[model samples]
Target: MPRVRALSGPKPRDAPEPSHPMPRHLRTLTALLRRAETVTLLAVLCVAGGLWAFAALAAEMLEGDLHVFDETLLMALRRAGDPARPIGGPHLEIVMRDITALGGITVLTLVTISAMVYLVLRRQRASALFLAVAVLGGQVLSRIAKAGFARPRPDLVPHGVDVTSASFPSGHSMMAAVTYLTLAVMLARQEPAWPIRAFFVVVAALLAISVGLSRVYLGVHWPSDVLAGWALGAAWALLVWLVARWMGRRGGIEPDRARPE
Candidate 1:
């Protein structure tokens, strides 16, 4: 008989030894990581909407398009005969001042420092550094916006609080949103439970809202200013959160249980 040609051609050279012999578990991890990154990118894109809102508001304000709206809201909060008198009487003013103090520089600084210290002691050094950068960068942005706009304070009503800064965006509202929201997001990442995470974010949002409202009630910030501050601050907070998530994915910081390494 003629020499029989090998039926299988040397077993197809051992099936070419599979170029990437990744383990099942490793492959699963890779898929999960890609999903996580996709989520982070989507979140950042959504946050851009908030920044766009702020830009729109600023543009409107500059064109005097919002003057009537701002004046209406500001005046509505005051007595018809006397613009100096806020609707809630003296006692309410005192309460508002106290609430406003919660967003004051002293309180925010203390809170930030305490939180950073706690994170540092827990050996989450990267997170602590991130917190500082978030807050300080926000402050810088606030200052630049104030100087750039040089918007005058509301002359229509007597300010309920001693005021000094340019009034295009409320510093109290913006800073409060930045500090509290950033802290809440970082803390939420450590907890795996959905309700707990929701609680953190919701409470942070309430605090920011209250601070912004107080600025308007106190006859200091124009309603539009408060709205702009909220928009910008929220965008900044979300940006910081996205940075944390991105960093965690790269193993540059302590990985979160939420990310599932």
Candidate 2:
């Protein structure tokens, strides 16, 4: 057979065994990262931050207008949370305000995060860290903002509940938004499908909005206060989500389960 060229000269070193194909999980993650969905998330967060900065600046510029509008809302909810005048019994309004305050949420968030850490220790350390950072940062920001505004609570309306914080923005509302929203995101990351993931996102949003509204309705917060708190809280939530995405990229937390093709 004309010497067959020595059977192709040492069999081409067995074709290097096809490089030992990566595991399915690794392959999938690599493919997901190649799509760069995390980059898009960071872009969205940037936009949100920019928008929040603009809103805060605008509110500062229109401090007089905002104060007027807030007084208007305060007038409407006179019976709900005016700590100055006892209306329909501060009892009911106090209960409602407590329902939306940070104390109960603090306990609830701690328990939830503790359980998640125990259950998902290997895959959720970074998520847990981001959660802690967001919560602490939000609390600090709220304190600073409240002190800077140093706006007195409305004495024109009945004060239905006791509050120690300044009245420019609702601290309880802000903290509830940040804490619950962050926990919701962490929970969403563990789910397998996108729809359920989206559902949780909506639920978190609704919870935050509802808490903000409760503050306004109870007359403990001005409408502007709640609005500012919502904007700031939403911005913080987006920032935390950005950090989580970075963690996912660095293989700190597990990849988000709902990656696209």
Candidate 3:
């Protein structure tokens, strides 16, 4: 019996363990990316809807249907006897002129160039290029819109400033929105604080609004023109931002790294 001990079977090697689950950080990043994508999509849809609504209004205006509305608004900004005098008096006219310049080609171009140079100096080449393209493309688009609509500047009131361009969509208003919003987004991305980001966005919006209103007050653009500009410009800026964000996530552009507390 002692010599009859059975030989022990060789031990089976431990089965290779299943691959580890994805890292927690990676999972978090994936979830954040999905959320960002959803938000971007929703924003784009809303922008498109706004642009469509504004475009419809512009079309009505071009058909001479919004004449009364546009004339009423333009006339209201002037004195009863004098179309030359805006409601806010001489000093206010000066102020409005100054504000309107913020959206002018020269001013906006300088701002864009300055921002681009700053980004380049920061080594944000992609961001600089993104900004340049957004602004230049906006300029081109504004020109095309003007040519396509071929609407005339308002004759209901006297002009506060000299303007010579088609007026279905105010180039000043649209460019203001495109430039300010794009710049604001670029600046805000550098900061991590929500309040700071909101401030940048709010300021940009206010500037765009003021510029559009100036055009109306000056009687160079109809209300619908400004509205259309705001809509289209906003849509363009948002579209550009979404593209940049997607590219950054894919490592095609520089990431906006989280700021240290």
Candidate 4:
């Protein structure tokens, strides 16, 4: 009885190690990546919508359903007493001529060439190449659109400027949006401040819009034509921007923030 001892219970297995929480920085990065993906998806959807809208408009125009609307807008810009003259006086005509020139091949090419040179000198070769592709591709697309639709220029009023191409989409309007918007985005990337970026974008939009309006005011293009040009041009620019961003993130191109000094 003196040596009687109680048996000890069997020991329990050790608990599995607690899983470690993800580091805060890693979590933040993951969230940012997710947000970027969401933004890209939205951008793609918008591009599709813009394309669909252009197609629908083109179809309607081909069917002659848009003639009334197009004619009304075109005629509205002309003087009531004289359809041969635009609503504005001769002075205004001169101003519009100057504005329209901003979107012409000469001016657009000069701007694009200058931008490319600057980007190249800054060691942003990828961006420079992309810019060249975007502008040149836009030109090709504009030509194709004109050939495909082959809509004649409005004859309801005297043209403010000489034009010979099919007029479903205004070349000046489309190229203006492409050139100005592309330049704006490239410039915005160099700025860290949101306000500065917004300013650049607004200015670009204004320039594009004014060019489109000038085309209509000059009686060279129908309102629908200008609208179609704007929609398609904006979509193309946005598509290029998305591609550039995606490439940058994948290390195919340098990030804007990491530009060489």
Prediction-by-prediction clash tally: 0, 8, 0, 0
Alpha-carbon RMSD of each model: 5.0, 8.4, 6.0, 4.1
Worst 10 residues of 3 by lDDT: 252-261
Error of 4 at 155 (Å): 0.5
Write the residue-wise lDDT of candidate 2 on 74-141 in tens digits.
Answer: 66655445335434455756666766764345664675568468536655665666666677787888
* Model 2 CA lDDT for position 111: 50
For model 2, state the Cα shift of residue 65 in Å.
Answer: 1.7
Q: On residues 127-189, what C-alpha lDDT tens digit does candidate 1 reach at each position?
A: 888889989999899888888888888888778789888998888888899989998888787
Clashing pairs in 4: none
Better of 2 and 4 by lDDT: 4
Ten residues in sequence with the least summed lDDT for candidate 2: 79-88
Looking at candidate 3, what is the lDDT of residue 176?
97
1-261 in candidate 4: lDDT tens per residue?
Answer: 599788989987699878999998898879877977897899899789879888888989889899889888888888887899887789998999999999899999999999899888888888888889989999999999999989989888878788988998889999998888888777676666767877988998899999999999998899999999998988888888787787877887667562211
In candidate 3, which residue pairs get closer than 3 Å at backbone N, Cα or C atoms, i.e. clash?
none
- Give TM-scores for every candidate, taking all chains together and pairing residue i with residue i: 0.84, 0.71, 0.85, 0.86
- Ten-residue region with minimum lDDT total, candidate 4: 252-261
Of candidate 1, the 10-residue stretch with the lowest lDDT total is: 7-16
True lDDT of residue 21, candidate 2: 75
